[model samples]
Target: MLNIADTLHRWCREERPFALATVVKVRGSAPLPVGTSVAVDEDGNAVGSISGGCVEGAVYELCRQVLDDRGAPQRARFGYSDDDAFAVGLTCGGELDVLVQRVDPGTRPYLATALADVVEGRPAAVAQVVEGPEELLGGMLCVDAAGGIRHGPLTGVLRREVGAQAWSLLRAGRTARAEVGGDAETCPERLSVLVHVHASRPRMLIFGAVDFAAALSQAGRFLGYQVTVCDARPVFATAARFPHADEIVVDWPHRYLEQAEVDTRTAVCVLTHDAKFDIPLLRLALGLPVGYVGAMGSRRTHDERLRLLSEAGVPEGQLARLRSPIGLDLGARTPEETAISITAEIVSRTNRATGLPLSALAGPIHAGTSS
Candidate 1:
């Protein structure tokens, strides 16, 4: 996918006319988060997506019209309601307000900066929410590399402190809430700054460097992971076999993870099932904050490994974190199929989604809150 903001900035800088479709507000089971944007140039070439695929066609038609009309920012709202309202709304039963605007002077500069940060992988995307006066709730902001704030509207001590807090959320690539009401009071609409953080992609530290490791490394890259395969056996750890991996290190697994470090953003998959290789590495991996830790093995093999881990004093809490049977219960029989199931589980776990279908579930399709 193209950088939606970058595409807009190019059109603006080239003195060419273009239109941008941005998600301004969302209520009731929205698919894409608010502030999602895409640019359609005068020639009808478009970049980025707004909904899963629902609203883009309509949003594009609106863009073609806006290219000729020059004025202040224009806003459009889209929603789904069983109760008839507008003729146009999402059929998925969610409400979203889309702000489509000409790439005019008003937003050209601000959008340019925002897209610059995103294209360069600068870690966050934030926007200002210009809602009316005293009802002039502050706005949103995001974090940067040095843990600094990018967008800000709140003022004084609270502003300064919350900016720092907002950066923390951005670093983790999550949306968060921060109180912007000057006093210790909390307001429902107190600058509900939706901090959009771009957590660095998870690092795949593949141990063993075997045929399975090679396949898993490729699979990891396909899934947008920064794959790194490492093994102390230099013969097996050659870069030729794993061209897709970002780093192929001939290093010990335990020492490599210890030094390179793994956070909640990292994913460690132990492909080397040999006890001498997998055990010590498992000991180190279990202690880290990685989101997904999967080790390839049969149920019988995993049980043995678990017993050994318990004997090694690896603590029940930490031991419980490992996905021993590795992937989900997909009954995968091949390396390719197994890799898919494993990665699917990892993605589902990262987004806090169960391995269940939306149709089977009862209420709304959100990870946490219900309306």
Candidate 2:
């Protein structure tokens, strides 16, 4: 799994055989999402986690069994049990369908190639046959960012179909499952393939090196963002001040952002409250195709900011995209609390969530994904 890519890559380099248990499907409120995995080395050591703590012991034992059985692949289903309180299952009342497969460099060469791509920050995806014919059970297909198949077993139309799906998943940076085959040329029956997307972490560009920015940088990094704190003042934007930031750039915020490679997955936070710094940076960030563009200020400052940007020729629609208050209404006053609120808003906007508590909703607790 990409979450533990570094550990897995290390194991591969050592030529150590291990069993990987990945959550391929979930039926209900799972704490962790699909593609979360737990790996166990041949020496009875383990790394990574499937569930936060719910069914790890069971999955670890499953990994041990796979190693003892000489790298045989297996499937396991875990759910809450009403009969036995000590049963190995999820306490959150969810079901996890786990696929345990052995990764041996001598046999599965594609595992190494896929893990290498992930560790090196190259966009890639590994399509594993989760449910299908007996012989094709644990087959894997590795696809790169350019829709090129680095390794796989399927050929002809089936290979093309799987490769296309893998490319789609990689572009979206999502780990999902798709059904392929069920044709004369491909396969008579439908086969389910779990595409484990290994995309680089998205970028979180925070302008202004204030205390709030420092707290936000730490929160963004925890949320899996490659955070960069940029400012025009070199005195404030130092590594010692923002130790959690991946990068600290002492440049004009707008000038630095003009050349940044931003995409729909990037989040641009304008924390500089000054009129000179805020106006130009927001003018550019608002027009760009980014996931979120938020600014920090009071109600009066927010109104003035909107007027300035409107006068600067920014469209009304684009101005609406700016989250002037920068965070949800969490009544937060401290820097750390504000950081939590800001990152919460970013996640809610990214996931298209309602920002409402689960108690107010009636459906599934966790968001649904293709499986």
TM-scores for the candidates = 0.82, 0.86
User: What are the clash counts of all predictions, listed in order?
Assistant: 2, 0
CA error at residue 67 for candidate 1, angstroms: 8.6
RMSD of model 1 against the true structure: 4.0
- Candidate 2 RMSD to the real structure: 2.9
Q: What is the lDDT of residue 10 in candidate 2?
A: 86
lDDT of 2 by residue, 243-360 (tens): 9999999999999999998888999998888999999999999999999999999999999999999999999999989987899999999989999999999999998889998899
Best prediction by lDDT:
2
Where does candidate 2 have its weakest 10-residue lDDT segment? 362-371
Candidate 2 lDDT: 0.89
